[model samples]
Target: MPQSHPASVSSRRILVAVVPPVLAAAAVLATFLSVRDRLPDRMAVHIGGGGHADGFSGQGSFLATALGVLVGDGVLFGALASWIRTNPGVQRVIAVIGGAVAVLTGWLIVAVLLANTDVADASSVTLPGVRAALAFAAAALYAAVGWLVCGKAEEAETVSGPSAGAGRLPLGDFETAGWTRVTGSRVLPVTGALVAATGIVVGFTTGWLPALPLLITGVPMALLTGARVTADRRGITVTPSLAPWPRLNVPLERIAEAGHRTVNPVRDFGGWGYRARPGASGIVLRSGDAISARLTTGSEFVVTVDDAATAAALLNTLADRERRTAAGG
Candidate 1:
């Protein structure tokens, strides 16, 4: 096994961590500056439940709100980076979630300002559905950027010396070892169902046209129904408990090696549930022990599960047997 180091924030990582928040701040600043002179002297800054502006503030107050959010977010994220430098994975998760929040907040502020501009009555202005759509879009865009920019950990070490008493299971003529477990968040599905239900209700109340944006929230909820993992002679397979048609099967023949490691779901895969990085993909239901298969195709696949060491040992043992059989040794 390769020696593990305590997580430390490198200079490069600090820079990467700050980029998203800074950009989000800049976006708000740019929008405010461009529209500052055009805004009404007393802008409608607050909306009532009836979908009309209920509170008014001077243009300066409106601009101050944007500045306040920017500064507050920057301080919060910077403090998080400095304090949690030791846990790179958790830090990365915070940075990404914070960035998304910053962008969406900025978008909301800017959208409200624009929507009220040149209006005859600020109080009568209602936030359009487009703003909600834009918020979701901004979140998706920042998430992708975060995934691309987040640093990659060094390749996990593999155990290759020998398995003297590795406890191998037999599969017909081939010796095999395997494990199965259910993985995912029990709370996620319920939350998704609730959101979908809310959207449906709102859609029906306001006309079916309002439900289109619900798809964004509904699809992910449906996908979070959980998954079942199985490993054996055929390699590793991840089947979604709700939908079995789209299973992930990694053939043993394609795997060059297998090993176990302690993993952070947020840091390593950005988050949980079938995450994909540049050269790696993981069925990470949660954080902690996991088995990683280094494939001949140069990609790494991981699954979080208990007793990962035994599963990895069996995988490596089976791979060796398959290789020897192929060579007719």
Candidate 2:
């Protein structure tokens, strides 16, 4: 296999991280120039619930807002790329976020401009399905950017091995115990709820129904505020604490081995809860100590938690006992 030079890789990473927002700005500028002559002198910048113009702004002001968003996002993502150079997963997240922001801003600018072109009232402009399409497109672009920038997962040594003695717990007849931890973040859920509420209010008051989509997007954010992990003799299970129905279960039968290691959530799983990279999926709420289970199927599942070593040890012991019992039967 051909090895990549460190400098070359770094340069590529920089380009990948920095280009999306800049391109977004450029696209916005180009679109504005194309329709500048057609826009009304004073555009209906905001609409009320009755589908009437409730707010107006000059073309320059509108342009400034769009430009500001583009520039601000570019600067933020560019800085993040530099600050998080060691973690490609986080870098990919930053790139995707930048791209999404750019796409959404550009889409909004174009939509508003197209609505106001030669039109006397902005309220008369209705985007029946276009807003949804733009949202979907933005989501698609974000995922694509993350996937492309992050590339493939490297083949790291498995977090655990088949050797029964390594970090194994002592056997006790009919002993069963478990540990549970909640990976909670104070900021994320509150922010998500607030944003969702704001979007709902905006949608109802402005008749810009596009804001209603925020409610759906915000739900995941709020749910991601915390993840609950439980490790017992059966195996390990991870679920979002806020919404626990859908869970990731790693049964003892599937676990070939288990262990704990230090990990960066951004570096390992690309920014939190129920994340999937090329080779593995994990419940990654934060960066630090985590337990990893190497499954018999060859896939790995990880979760960041406190006392990961104990969890791994218990899991290994239980799994070994299960295998031995089955063999004897």
Candidate 3:
């Protein structure tokens, strides 16, 4: 039988994931109600380049669609949070992302309505470029708030035990061993560049404000394009090859066992670059050799790289030596 998350944990996650989006949806609905009398029957809901309203919709339909999307986000993220029984790290990330997205959507919709208010001609309405920046700011602010709302990771949490494996390196007493390998996704660079290029095209066609989100997403993807995976007495560390910070370090004490496995990026991890599924999470690049580490948190952290077998062996040997030292052997 699988373990169930505590009632409090379940409620916390559900609340964090669903409540913000629901509230944002309610706010959007309220704004629609307050401004419906003033807004034109057919109003501009979509803005294109030069701040021109290209898409027009009835006020009611617009509100319905906006609210539906906001609520849909709440529902989707809520369901995802429920499926995650443990691993607060992933839960917190999800909570912040969901909340931020809801806030962004709500903020943008409100901006649209406000721009059209008291306007005699719906086609003449021009949403200020600043609204895009404002929406991004609101999302960033809500992300911080969401982070504050969720409980921190449980440092004292313990799993049943580590997975037993037989891949220890032949390290003698006082003999040191270390493994280093560079591995990355084949698709990240090209995809990120393409997205950034698209943003540039959109900026030229529309406005810089509309392209902000895409650039924000693509720039980071382009920067943190690859990973350097290393294993030593320090356990395992995976960091961006181009940067020093924002690394994942599973300390020696947290590692249960290490082994190599074949990873299917989409099938196992859903996508690339630090993905999380129910019981597992990984820095998946291409689908090939990966170092799978069973963690004390009862979750697995995988990093795909070449020469993974040797890396796993070194980790197992270090773990055995640590156990012996702790036992006063």
Q: Between candidates 2 and 3, which one is better according to lDDT?
A: 3
Q: Where is model 2 more than 4 Å wrong at Cα?
A: 1-10, 13-17, 26-42, 46-61, 76-97, 114-166, 190-214
Q: What is the TM-score of each candidate against the true structure?
A: 0.56, 0.72, 0.57
lDDT (10s digit) by residue, model 3, range 1-329: 54444666556766877887888888888888898889999988878866788778888778887778788789878876665535466666776777787887788888888988999999998987788788989899878877877766553333222233448789898999888988977677776787698677545433566578878878787766688999999999998888888988888888888888887665455446778665677789888878888877777878889988889889989998998888899
Q: Which residues of candidate 3, in runs, are more than 4 Å off? A: 1-10, 48-52, 129-133, 156-164, 168-257, 260-272, 275-282, 285-290, 293-329
* Best-to-worst lDDT order: 3, 2, 1
In candidate 2 the C-alpha lDDT for residue 63 amounts to: 78
Clashes of each: 1, 0, 1
Which of the two candidates, 1 or 2, achieves a greater lDDT against the reference?
A: 2
**TM-score (C-alpha) between model 3 and the true structure:** 0.57
Clashing pairs in 3: 49-206
Candidate number of the best TM-score: 2
Query: How many steric clashes does model 2 contain?
Result: 0
Clashing pairs in 2: none
Q: For candidate 1, give the lDDT.
A: 0.67
**lDDT, candidate 2, 1-329, per-residue tens:** 88665445544555655666677678767877898888778886665655456666788877787678678767876676666555555565666666665666566666666667778665565443556477558757765865565554243323342222338878686887787888766546775787687567545433456576778767667767777888887699888776767888888999888887776665555455567754577777777778878878787778888888888888988898889888994
lDDT of 1 at 94: 67
